[model samples]
Each structure stands twice: as C-alpha cells, then as structure tokens.
Target: MQILLLGGHGKVALHLTPLLLKRGWNVTSVIRNPDHESEILALGKGLKGNLNVLLSSLADVKSAADAQKIIDTVSPDYVVWSAGAGGKGGPSATIAIDQEAAKHFMTASFASPGVSKFLMVSYLGSRKKQPSWMSDSEWAGVVKVNTEILPTYAKAKQEADEYLTALAEVRKRDPNASRFQAINLRPGTLTDEPATRMVDLGITPKGRGSVTREDVAIVADLLLARSDTEGWIDLVNGEEGVEGAVERVAREKVDAVVGEDVEGMVKRFFPEAGLKF
Candidate 1:
C-alpha cells in the first residue's frame, strides 16, 4: 500500500515511516522544513522500501484550494493527517496548522481521486463527548506554560476532530456518495518509552492509560492494512501483545462465514473479519 504522511518529522511519523517501509509499503512524507529531508531519508537507510518527500507546510496553506493542490499532485492511496503547530507556535499558529489545515485536508480528500483512506493520529480527548481540549483537564499544566497557545491548541484539535466526524457521518449515511474512508485513532498520554506493541482499544477502554509512540505507529500500520476497519478506536497500553491483540479480534466468531474465512482476512491484514459493521 502507498501512504502519504503529513508532519513527517513528528516523533510518531518518523518511527512509522521506517516500519511501513520494512513492511514493503510505499511512504511519502509531506514536510514543511527542507532541512529535515535528510533526517526523514535516514529512516530508510539499509531498509527495503520507497520513501518520497513533498515540500509543503500546512501553515502556508490558506484554504482548501491550497491543500487540494498538494493532494492532487501526490495522489496517494492513503493520507495520514499528522501535522501540528507544536509548542513554539502561538494561538493563531495552532489554529492555522491544527484546525484550519485539517479541514482543508478533509475537503481536499473528498475531492481528490485515488485517495480513499484517511488515518488520523488524534488525542484521546478529541471526541463528541468532549470536543474542545479546554474541556478536559489533561492539558491543565500545559496551559500554564504557554498560556496563550496551549488552550488554543486543544480547541483547534477539538474543532478539527469534529469536522472529521461530520464528514465521516456523511460517508456512513451514503456509502455510495463517496469512496473515501476515514478512521481516527485517539491514543492516551503518549510517552517516548519503548513500544509494548500491545493496545487496548474501544470507544472507551477501562483504566488509566498511556501508549508509546512506536506502538501507535504499529497500530496505524495494522489499521492501514485492514481495508474493512473504520471509525474511532480509543487506544491505550494493554496486556496482549500487538500481533496477539489483532489475532484475537480476527478469531472471534461471527455469523457471516466459517472460521477459515475470518482467519484468512486477519492473517492478510484485515480486521473485524466476518463481523457486522
């Protein structure tokens, strides 16, 4: 599969690109800084994979038209919306990069041909039950650090996630209306620790949680290969191993077909096989 990742220099994307490459998938990362090109290319060193780069910044994209130009030019099979303004950028910058640019990407994806999948690496708090980041206390400490921009970043993510949900609803209501498919993975407090390669996922997974950036990339890879999976899945570190977790789900009995059919899809990167949507 071919994947285009925005915010290619981010911690998660940097780890993700290499993994996808090892799996024999093509990866193209869109980045704002030309200087970071070497770092991104370095991930593929001695690895068998194709890595491409596109020079673009969400900050410079004024509207959906600007975003469309990039999507049209790349024409990737899948798009991963991972870009953000980071801590240095102020409120306006946060809104521009996180909220407005995300909206533009969604609009562009709907219009672009050959771009059927969108995988978003969102936060655990970005959901309908709690839309804005300010509404959640997880960011209380960050607010004190960058008083002007921290809260704004949360609000920006909230709005962007809402926009994605609305568009997803449109697709669900009229499957034939659009060929695009989107899934948002909302992971709990991200840490820089080594990956556990295991995750507990659902609309709501019990217990306090955290997940490694490397593990999040693995989940992204699994989801990308699964053509039948869609919608939001709350993620957190879990007891089961990464491959084990996916295997368990694939083995669950469903009325649609015999055991072998489900196993075939799961072994080949399909999830929730033989289950109703």
Candidate 2:
C-alpha cells in the first residue's frame, strides 16, 4: 500500500512512519524543510517500505486544485493529515495550515481516483460545544484554553473536523463520488511518554486525559488497517488493550455527536447503564 503522510516532521508522524514501513507500505512524506528528509528516510532504513520525501509546504497549498495536483502526483492509496502550524506563525498561520490546507486536501481527496482512506490526527476536544458529561470545572479549563490560550488552534481544528464530517455525509449520499473512508483520530492531551498499547477508544467522551504519542501512533496504524472503521474516535490512555479497543469500536457502530447530549449517545454504547443524569 502507498500512503501520503502530511506533516512528515511531526512527533506523531515520525513515530508512525516506522510502523507503516515495517508493514512494507510505501510512504511519501511531505515536509516543508528539506533538512528533515534524511531524518524521515532514516526511519525506513532497515524496513521494507519505500520512503519518498516531497519537498512541499502545506501553507503553499491554497486551493483544492493545488492540493489535487499534489495528490495526482503521489497517487497514494491513503492520505494522513498530521500537519499543523504549531502556533509558530500566529493565528492566521494556524488557519492557513490547519483549517484551510486540511480542507483543501480533503476536498481534493474526494476527487482523487487513487485515494480511498484519509486519516486526520486531531484533538479530542476539537468541538464547538462541550460534552454533557464533562464537569463544570473541566469544561471551564477547556474553555480557558480554547478561548485564551490556543483559541485559534482550537478553532482551526474544530472547523477542519466539521468540514471533513460534512464531506463524509455528502460522499455517503452521492453514489458517483469516489469510494472513500475518513477517520478522525482525536487523541487527548498528547505526552511524550512510552507506548503502553492500551487506550480508551469510542464515540463517547472519556473525560480529560493524556495519551502517549507512541500509543496514538499505534492506534493510527491499527485504524488504517481496519477498513470498516470510519468516523470520529475519542482516544485516551486507559486499561483496554489498543488492539481490542479498536476491534470493539469498529464492530459496534457509534454515531459522532457535536452537541452536549449525553443520554442518547451513552445509551447507544452502554444500553444497560441505568445511571441517572
């Protein structure tokens, strides 16, 4: 399999590269800096996958047409949007790379003939409204970060996710559209801890928590292999094994929610839970 991985220099993407390579899948990693080419190539040194570095910046991709041109050249079977502005270029930069570039690539993917699967590494709290089950204190903290700390970054991710969800819906109704599947792997606060290979993956919120970058990479690899898994997934460090958690979530269909509705969403996953809201 061939995969086009955006944000090749990212922490998560770097960790994910080896897993894909070990599977003998060819990966074309797109990076803005040419210096990082050797670093990315080094990951596939002993692996079977072919590594190709595309010297391009996501900021330059302004339109769907521009993104489509890159897609046409790569002709990848899967696309991973792991790139972000990282707050270096300010709010406008965040919107340009995170929101606009992401949407453009996704839109381009819908038209690309070879692209079938698109994976987005997003934040677990990337939503317009807080979940109903979240405590007031927790929600307040999240609001502070979203409004004061990283407001632009949060908004960019939220908008990008919404755009992807809308595109998935449109594709579902249009039979003539290219056959595609999109997975929004929303991981909680990311940490540089070691890989535990254990996580809580589901549609419902798993409260505020931190997940290891390695574990997130593992989950991304697993999700890519499972063709039946699509839609948004909430991920965090938990007791369940990554493989089992992914299998269970993939077997059971859970609808993604944007509002603060808890009862309906919870009951769908845990029908016997008689807890009162």
Candidate 3:
C-alpha cells in the first residue's frame, strides 16, 4: 500500500512512519522543513517499505487544486493528515493549517482517483455537542478547552471534523464521486509517554483523560489497515489492547455526529462552501 502522510516531523507521525514501513507499505511523508527529511527517511532505513520526503509547506496549499496537485503527484492509496499549527502562529494560523488546509486535502482526496482513505488526527473535544455517555464534569472540561483555553484550535478541529463527516455523506449519496473514505481518530490529551499498545476506542467519550502519542500512532496504524472502519473514533489510554479495541470498534458502527442531521450539519458548519449533494 502507498500512504501519503502529511506533517512528517510530528511526534505521532514519527512513531507512525516506522509502523507503516515495517508493514512494507511505501510512505511519502510531507514536511515543510528540508532538514527533517533525513530524520524521517532514517525511520524507514532498514524497513521493507520505501520512504520519500516531499518538502512543502501546508500553509502554501491555498486551495483544493493546490492540494490535488500534491495528491496527484503522490497518488497514494491512503492519506493521513497529522499536520497542525500546534497553536504556534495564532488564530489565523490555526484556521489556515488546522481548518482550511485539512478541508482542502479532504476535498482533494475526494477528487483523487488513487486515494481510497483519508485519516485525520483530531482531538477528543472536536465537537459542539456533548455525548450522552460523558459525565457533566467531563463535558465541562471539554467545553472549557473549546471555549477558552484553545478556542481557535478547538473550533478549527470541530469545523474540520464536521466538514469531513459531511463529505463522507456526500460520497455515500453520490455514485459518481470517488470512493475514498474519511476517518477521524479523535484522541484525548496527548502525552510524550511510551506506547502502551492499550486504548479505549469507540464512539462514546472516554471521559477526560490523556493518551500517549505513541499509543495514538499505534491506533492510527491499525485503523489505516482496517478499511471497514470509518467515522470518528474517540480514544484514550486504557486497559484493552490496541488491536482488540480497534477490532471491536470496527465491528461496531460509530455515529460520530449525533443530535444533528447531515444536511443540517453541512449547512450550519459550511454555509458558504456551497457543497453539493
């Protein structure tokens, strides 16, 4: 399999590249900094899969056409969006990279014939409504982050997730559209801890918790292979093995967006985009 991974220099991407390479799946990692090329290439040094680094800035990707060019060049079977502004360049930067860039890629993926799956690394609180399974305290914490702490980042993620979900619906309704599926892996607060290979994955919230970047990468790797799974998966550090958790979630259907219809969601989240059914 050929995978196009955006944000090659990210911690999660760093962990994920090795896993994909070990599986003998060729990966084309996109990074803005040329200096990181060797570092990423080293991860696949002795692995079966070939590694190629594409030096490009996601901020420079202005539209779907710009993103489609990259997708066409790579022609990957799977595309993973791990890139983010990391809350570094302010609100505009967050919107540009986290929201706009992500949507561009999603739109481009839909148009790309070679792309079959587009996986997004999103946060656990990337939704406007709280799930019924979550407790009051848990929902409050999520709201705090979305409304105050990382407001811009949270809003960007929320909109991006909504847009991707809407696009998935569009794909289902339109027979002529490309068959590429969109998957959102929403993990809890991230940490630098080692991989536990254990996680809680499903549609319901796992309360307020944190997960290791390594564990998230492991889950991402597994999810990429499980083509049967789609929609948003909420994850956190837990007792269940990663493989088992992923398998269980794959067997069960996850309605990522609840309390809102697809048409309403698209209209509310993307009023100006003019997304056609």
Q: Which is the leading candidate under lDDT? A: 3
Candidate 1 at residue 124, lDDT? 67
For all candidates, the clash counts are 0, 0, 0
- Global lDDT of each model? 0.71, 0.85, 0.87
lDDT tens digits, residues 39-127, model 2?
99999998999999999999999999999999998999999999999988988999999999999999898778788999999987777
Per-residue lDDT over 60-116 for candidate 1, one digit per residue giving the tens place of the 0 to 100 score: 988989988888777788989878888557778889888899888877886676788
Q: Please identify which of the two predictions, 1 or 3, would achieve the higher lDDT against the true structure.
A: 3
Q: Find the number of clashing residue pairs for candidate 2.
A: 0
Among all windows of ten consecutive residues in candidate 2, which has the lowest summed lDDT?
268-277
In candidate 1, clashing pairs total 0
Clashing pairs in 1: none
- lDDT score for candidate 3 against the true structure: 0.87
The sequence of per-residue lDDT tens digits that candidate 3 reaches over residues 1-277 is 9999999999999999999999999999999999888899899988999999999999999999999999989999999999999978889999999999999999898777778899999988888777788888888988998888989999899888888988887677666665666889999989998988887777655556889999999999998987788888888998899898888888877655665466877666556653554
